[model samples]
Target: MYDAVEALEGRQFDVVYTGKGALCYLPDFAQWADVVHQLLKPGGSLYIVEFHPLLNAMGSVALPGDTDDLIIRNDYLEGRGAIAHDTTVTYTGDQIPGRQRSFEWMHSLGEVVTTLAATGFQITRLRESEVLQWPRFNGMHQTPKGWWRLPDEAPRIPLLYALLATKSD
Candidate 1:
């Protein structure tokens, strides 16, 4: 996985876009930042929109036979090592044919920004949103734009975030 981006170094880009379920799969953010830096030209920009680490830590929000309670079921920061997940069933409730496994790592908001900045990327903008692309909580309601968010009574917390940075010239 580390060598995958090395090939892309030959090509320079003005903008690199990545996010969502992407970061969790990556075991190392520093390596990722360095590789991304190598792919971009001087002053190039990198935009990332991902699920907040807090979202990964919380549990029982909206699952089968689960309540609406905000529970801390997992780590909010990386360093504990990879989290193994059963891949037999997908998040959409679809059943797969064979048994499979996958691993993920939680990257906190601070870690993400720090890694990028440490790689010499100029932090431009970071936005956190309470809305999610899917109904993550039992009381979540769909917005006008079709996104989902907790109801007025539920405590507001960021479920997703977008970060924008630029490489120094």
Candidate 2:
């Protein structure tokens, strides 16, 4: 991450993209948000696609049995809480390996909005979707766009959201 920033530091850009990969693993959203704002050109836009915290809580580790077997099975009310799970994911040029250790911090729908607002971005749109690009868990209804959804459990609420913000022109 440092290398990527160093390459961009001092160079003007029109748009900056950030994703907390796998589980929105942003230990410090404020710091990253601040850096992204700094790199933007006047009238630039920031297109951020983040995984809903609920997806984070449900460990990514694939289960040997049904997909439901791997989830934390909680409503996912946003706040500070502890969830321990073995998440299966692929790392850059490497595999996460089965049973890798990972942690996630829950942020409510409102929390994401407020956090970005405090960072000085004007909200243009908050789009939601249940599209599962990759398999996050088992028992998900497959969609053409690769979204795995719990048709019976959660149809209205999405498992991910994309937020678009812009700097004051």
Clashes (N, CA, C under 3 Å) per candidate: 0, 6
Candidate 2 colliding pairs, count? 6
| Poorest stretch of ten by lDDT in candidate 2 | 66-75
Q: What are the Cα lDDT values of the candidates?
A: 0.89, 0.65
**Per-residue lDDT of model 2, residues 1-169, tens digit only:** 4334567666767887766463245455566666666777777888878777666555534556534444555546555554444657544335565668766556666776787678787889888777666655556677766667766664354668888888764
Superposition TM-score, candidate 1 onto the true structure? 0.91
User: What lDDT score goes with residue 79 in model 2?
Assistant: 51
Predicted structure 2, TM vs. truth: 0.69
Please give the lDDT score at residue 4 for candidate 1.
52
Off by over 4 Å in 2: 1-7, 20-23, 58-100, 152-155
